[model samples]
Target: MVAVTSSVPVTDPTLLDALRSDLRSADYTLDGVRSLLGPVAADALDREEALPARVVTASALASGADGRATLLRLFQLGEDVTRAALDAVLPTLRTAGAERLGLVATQGADDGDAVRAVVDLSPYAAVDAAGEVDWWIASDLGEVARRGALPENFVLGVGGASRTLAQITVREPRGSVLDVGTGCGIQALHASRHAGAVVATDIDARALAYARFNAALAGVRLDLREGSMLEPVLGETFDLVVSNPPFVITPRGEAGVGEFTYRDGGAVGDDVVRSLVTSVGSVLAPGGVAQLLGNWEHRRGEDWAERVGGWLTESGLDGWVVQREVQDPAQYAELWLRDGGITPDRDRARFEGAYAAWLADLDRRGVEGIGFGLVTLRRPALAGAAVSPWRRVEEITGTVAQPLGATIARVLDAVDLVRDLTSEALLGRRWQVAGDVTDERYFTPGEASPRVMLLRAGGGFARTVRTETGLAAFVGACDGELTGVQIVAALGTLLEVDAAALAAELEPQLRGLITDGLLLPAP
Candidate 1:
């Protein structure tokens, strides 16, 4: 068996060292890039000492092409950003028939130097620069002459999901903030921009050290802990808990060539993500909020929303759950298998073994499929430990930091006012059944929904209205201007059914919709 260690040690020490030693290193500098349009805080890390540093890549600030290709194109944009400090490595990289050295993290990559000796100044630093980014700020350190972003594991960059978590996080001065699975401390770094105190935790020691170095260089204080979620912050509670946990459902005990310490969260299935969610509840003060990125099982009989909702239920808090993306078993399996697939000399045996292991683990645990994305929860204010659950389905993509804090505050302040809610249901009208929105599988106790729901077609705010036939008819009549009785009467007239019978049929669902915020009555 080949040697695969959990926490490998790096041999180098500074920024330039990592790059010059590699076959070819790369980073970028663009001339026309705009600076922050407003007055922004300068020099974020100033007081702390450098333990060691590495660039915790969030995403390739989107430049061109698609997926990975777009990332490489982004690299081409860095012209002057890179230091011509040594220019010695460029010739060697060229002679090696590879790209020039751009920027290098002081510590990362199996073959690269550990001490940061090379700076990844290549333009690819901002892989997905196209998304909603407030400002790309880096702590300027005099000790190291490099500035760039990339994972030590060399996994997916700060793509849409990473940026989403950054954007959704509430930025405010608080007593403390904990960034679990602090990949390169992007979220922690972001928190340091405002929070009074910051603590970041990661199972990967290298990652923890990088977070420490970055926080120090930025002149900020972030308590960096090297351990699993909550374990690092045990006996602690915070005003805010944010994490981009390693929710990738890699097969159990599966390790490969490039599955860097950066992304993998390490719980068999949805366990890691769920653990993060549940733990945040325990560590957050009442009224404190926890925002996390995760992946969960889209089990045969379970409702994804409800499954996530249940985490909130037992947590003694108020919760908001949103399933941003879902992937089928095959598609989900292939993406991760391929992630491990890209490493050097990776073959079918390794890939298939990893994939099969993942399947088997899920099968043993009774997990039907895997789903990934973001979820946010707010610990309840009341002391009885009863959970006040509120849910919504929102794109929230294209928004800024303001919405996250504001929306959560709004929800909490008006938590008593809103009902069982589904944004897709309340935002539009005239939704169709059978064709408009449908589920893949259902639980029957009949008979609920199933594995996945198909959105066959839609006109306005389309969603699989999770109500019965009678409830759908009743909801169609509620435009916030009708009472429950009035809605039932309207449905009764349209269906040529008795009003009393229709009311009786629709009451349970109507109550649920109102409770979940799907249907709002006339004020």
Candidate 2:
């Protein structure tokens, strides 16, 4: 790919308004794009394969596909078009207006001049904790459009990581939010929907420019700051802070390896993610919440939980870390190498060198594997409130419910509710099974009594737990009509056991059930 000097997108309010209006009028939205491409082409595009999309798009356009297809081919497919064709799609904005906004560049001085997109623009739709939303986002063109490695300062549009952070983020209405490492401002845009004010910060000027352009296009206001990590937000406290930071653990001082601003935080090993985990607590207001994605190195003889728990201990916040995936050093290296468009077939020697450098760096640091996961931290509402802070580290690699933001909020609430409740108090309250929970029983052949009983959750983390006979009976007895104490006492009577002993035995398990969301506190 030839090197091109990409300028920061222009930010003119009137031009942005006109562009938004044109897009809306032309029905250039996620649904519109999907309808134009259909399922197969869209699915192919999602996999980063453009041949099917190009074929379908070409066929559709040849058969008189409308304005949406033309815009899609121009902006998303990176196809240059005649001025008249672009004008037909963007009747309100036109070629001149788009050029003024820095969205496109004109190649020749004529009405039939070739116009090309300077940035990649696409429609992003999501169902966050706050229902559904649709917006147009602009960022640097990706490998699919450029047909090569991404530029170092390339701003990323909405992708898998963006959607993951969005879906997992707790989106309750808040006073303020900070979106650190906000490449193209996707998270900040989602924050703006629920937060009173949002501040988006990034170290890359080009990224900020794309973020500004995207916010303006979406008609959402943001305080765009230029700095690294938490530097821009120092001395500021926010009720909610969200980030999908550059937590990729890359080998430092490795020559010939491109350090993309969107993935590399200029730190060796996993220091970048560690620093954020330890220091982000300073910017969180009392009772504030911060959710971020990170990669942690699992060194020799240390469990993944222990390593991540150490970071939480240093941060002094209530932390819950979920390890979603782990990759060996070699696999991790190859994954990122291919991501940068460097493949064994294209550049075998270069690929081998980069791979060897990555493995050597991991070996030097005694890193066995890289663990990627989501980290959620909350500042205790008041000093000394979490003297023994709530910390949970687990792995859930299986499928979970979509829009986990709501589930996360519920977990936080449940944690807080059960943290201070005494065993006596917990048993005194009425309890009921959650709607998404079910009981499963396994029996030995020709046996009346089940050999094993399990409780499974159908949503959220999709958790499963083995239950004892007494606990299983107790859960079956809960119907929101009786208090836990009544059910336990009745069970104890039927089993010829002491009521107090049974209550004592089941108290901790009951608390676990509550915290895991299999059981709910009845009103």
Candidate 3:
């Protein structure tokens, strides 16, 4: 096999045009990337055995869709299979379209690789400085086989986590937002939409350059700071912070990077994320929120939730940690090793050792599993003291994404526990829950020692009232048009219970329901 290279001849006008059209269409399909020029076919991207081929086929997903949607869907192609696909396609495109590829490099002046794609196509240049990350997206719906073959060396592009971050990020105009690792700068660019200014920082100068160039091309303003994590933003607090730092528990090199700069953080696994969280509190302004994607080891005696929960207990912040996915040690080992291209035929002992280390790391720590999800922190009021560590929400991603910015503003404005929110006014309506009462009613009678039953058939916050009769029938009478006194008086007559006692019980229970968000206080 010989390396194949093509130089674009100006005389071949039609071929260039066709290539351009393919790129243009792909770019559109992929979100604003313009085009994807491969030096060879995609199939042989890493085929040192096959690289020299004069011509082969290659595919670039193209860069032309809205960055968030395009990249999300493309990278969503799972980890393993996506890699194999890029390997197969890029080499072919590179060799056959060498002429066009040269033009791409020379024209864009970005020939130096760092991993380039039309958003959905790829993120970090698949080619790394050493060009040794052996990520190969597989063929077949292999390895859950999502994502196409990616440049083995370069970091890969956006995925579901990135999209979730993009979606939940409060879309308010702010002074600046820092995308800590700035892998592909997706967060930085996304922040630019609502933020007055955006800065993307990364220790990888190569990544910084790609971020700057990509931002410029897309007409998004950015301050590309080349420095490690939050250090560059020292002394300067941001209105918001977002990061998709490298949290692959597996170390690079031995594990082989799924894409070098992208996934491999350092030998200290997950150090990038820990650093980001511990220090992120300082850079966040009062009311500022740092949204981060991370993976925490499930330590033996220590809980995965507790590890992450601890990260959020900064001096001045209220935090929420949602643990979405967990993978046991064994399952985790095989999954990532596969990403590193650890074939039995290649190196057995080394791969086996890597797996052993991973398992040992987990076992030593008493980690039952690995947990992944979002961590959000808001700067706390200076006067407040104790910060706590806790595991609260299970549906972390969905819950965060559910909050409308305006609604969140309301939550922040409350400035008090939700239960205390007695009166409610919204969108031109007034709501109050007074007559609602609760009763610990019983079913199947004697089988129950006792049961507290609650029912709120109607009324704002669905006015809940408990009944010892299993349904003291107090809630059945909340007509917004009438006052609590009137409804209670009527229920007293109907249910034959002391209406005043029922309404009193109802008040506390209904308030609790409103506080819990089981019901939205009607406006």
Which candidate order results from sorting by TM-score in descending order? 2, 3, 1
The total of clashing pairs for model 2 equals 0
How well is each residue in 46-128 modelled by candidate 1, as lDDT tens digits?
11111211111112223321222211222322212112222333433321111222233222223322323221222112222
The alpha-carbon lDDT assigned to residue 225 of candidate 1 equals 78
lDDT of each: 0.49, 0.88, 0.50
Ranking by lDDT: 2, 3, 1
Q: By TM-score, is 2 or 3 better?
A: 2
Candidate 2: pairs in clash: none
TM-score of 3: 0.60
Models 1 onward score TM values of: 0.56, 0.97, 0.60
Query: Which portions of model 2 miss their true places by more than 4 Å?
Result: 1-4
Error of 3 at 378 (Å): 1.0
Give model 2's TM-score versus the native structure.
Answer: 0.97
**What lDDT does candidate 2 reach at residue 334?**
87
Indicate which candidate wins on lDDT. Answer: 2
Q: In angstroms, what RMSD does candidate 1 have relative to the true structure?
A: 12.8
- Model 1, which residues run further than 4 Å from truth? 1-157, 216-219, 254-259, 301-306, 341-349, 364-366, 385-405, 416-523
**Mind giving the per-residue lDDT tens digits that candidate 2 earns over 246-278?**
988888878756687899999988999889999
